[model samples]
Target: MKRSRNEHNSSQEEQEFLRESKLVARSPQHKEKVKQPEPSMDEIKQMLRDLKKDLHEDMAQIKREIQNDIREMREDIKDTKKELQKNREEMKSMAKEITQMKEEWTREKEELHNKIKEVEDKMERMEKQKIRNNLTITGLPTNTDNEDTLEEALEKMFQTELLLKTKIRRAQKIGQDRCIVEMVEWNDKIKILQGKAKLKGKDIFIDSELTRNEQKIQKNIRDIAREEKKKGAIVKVGYQKLEVNGKKMKWDHRSQKLTEANKLKN
Candidate 1:
């Protein structure tokens, strides 16, 4: 086949390159490759030492970085431990303060209760003093439908039954059958109470008027007196006390019952 002009030029250029390469290979001006001599033991040792030094330096750098990281971690752990210990100490102090507050609250509560009780006793004493000259008449029949009032009826009964002319300051019915009578003179009240024995066989009765506190105390004493009498002991119920075998017993406000008069202080 006939080659094109450009193809013919490319084939000629390849042949020229081959001929030039052959000449350059055979010429003395182009020096032959020298044979490399084997390394001596000293040189080989030096190379190994250089390589080891480089590797050791790299390894030392890595070890230092790791040690620094470990130190930082230890510091963090120490800091965390210190924070935890501080929290524990704070909690202990708060617990101690709470305990102290609780004890103080309890003591103050008891003192407040005692002060309130003292106030109540003082008020009760003043109330009892006001009604000292009053008397209570039980089992005295009152006719509400009759024209005669309770006061007129009581005055007539006192004059007829006790043979005494006592001037009453006030006369009022308290409950269903009881009459509270306030006498003008303290001596008149004393005489009326002494004359109560005359109406013993009849259904009438007379007794001193008592305050609410005194009534409660009298009730407690009567209960104790009844129990003592059941045990064959000599027992008597007084104003607000009980006499058991000649031993005087008073009402204890704290215990809310009768206690021996001597032991009441204790």
Candidate 2:
């Protein structure tokens, strides 16, 4: 039985060996894949150097761009400053021109004003001379429309009321109760004015023919005389003058009022 068991074990081992051989025969052969070799130290250093060179080039380009931007900003600031300075200069010049023009205009205006005043004074003198030998008669009746009749009537008045012989150059009715008479002689007008008080009871009046400006001044003088008379102070109104309390008053063209004659002596 031991011999049979050994033979039986040998047959099982032989069958297992045959099965392994069949499996090895039927399977495909696999070749070994070759692997890449690891890098040496020198190769690794070279790669690192190339990467560093590329990074440095990029950094250099970025720095150059930053410098260009800074230079452009500086140029812009310089241009702005130059423009501001130019504006300031132009404004100053304009201000100077305006001041000069204003001064010249003021001077011209003053000269024009003085010239107008001078012309007015000259015209006033001419007007006063034109009416030097004229007289204005008031309180006459409008009895006739004839110029000869009016002249005859005024001649009769001079003969009867004033008791003065006067040659009437021209006599015309100016209004219902007024007439302006031009005398051939200036002394005749003076005589008629001097003898005007004689016709006070007859309701006849005589006065010198005055310019409009003189008439206004005479009116103001009479007003001042009336006020002084009311105040119990002696006042006399004559032609274009006023006398208050025995002091002569002159008309001030500048002030347009009566002022003491002595006050203007200074």
Candidate 3:
């Protein structure tokens, strides 16, 4: 009787295990676990690929922006170079214009100088011509009986001393002891000037009348000429010139020095 009861207990345990197994297989929670699964390697790889693509797009956009900036900078540098080149060219042109202006000013100055020289020379010649027929006599006795006219007295004096026929255009007492005589004839003026040696013993001096400027120049030349004359040079002075042993000297308006008469520059 104990053996039969033990077999019956063993069969009952097996039947209970089969019933639990069937219930687990048929449950909704167990079916849902069976349907879902962990991700595969291929799906993970596709997500990684999408992330890489986005990163590459961002890098490409940044590269394009940098390239545009570089292009703009190069354009600005090119514009600056052109502006500098234009400025340099303008400077060169202005310098050339300035040089031309200087040359033009120099030429005008020289022309003006020449014109002034010409005018001075013409004036000098005209001034000398005016005094050519005139004579100045110094050391004449003024205390003597006064004649009716100075022209008569001069004519009488020349006739008595040198037997010269005197024909005077005008005559006057210039100072306390001097006389001025103007002759009508140039030849007579020359003759009287040359014949002054005949009146040397009378303590009188004779000279040609000159312009004030020429007289001053003559005085300077006479001073130098006198010194040279004492040293054995044949020196003589005219109104505006001097001759020392055939070498001529004249006053130069430009140089302001007594230079050689013939060799002065125009």
| Best-performing candidate as measured by lDDT | 1
The number of the candidate with the highest TM-score is 1
C-alpha TM-score for every candidate: 0.60, 0.59, 0.58
Give the least accurate 10-residue stretch of model 1, judged by summed lDDT: 142-151
Candidates arranged by lDDT, highest first: 1, 2, 3
Clashing pairs counted in every model? 0, 0, 0
C-alpha lDDT of residue 58 in model 2: 94
- lDDT-best of 1 and 2: 1
| CA lDDT scores, all candidates in order | 0.87, 0.86, 0.83
Runs of candidate 3 exceeding 4 Å displacement: 1-73, 143-148, 161-163, 201-203, 219-254, 260-266
Could you tell me how far off, in angstroms, the CA of residue 48 lies in candidate 3 after the best superposition? Answer: 9.2
Model 1 lDDT per residue over 163-201, tens place:
999887888877778878888888888999999899988
Global Cα RMSD, each model: 8.0, 9.6, 11.7
On residues 26-134, what C-alpha lDDT tens digit does candidate 3 reach at each position? 8867665446687789988988999999999999999999999999999999999999999999999999999999999999999998998888778888887887789
Q: Model 2, range 37-124, lDDT digits (tens) per residue? A: 9999999999999999999999999999999999999999999999999999999999999999999999999999889989988888
Better of 2 and 3 by lDDT: 2
State, as a TM-score between 0 and 1, how close model 2 is to the true structure.
0.59
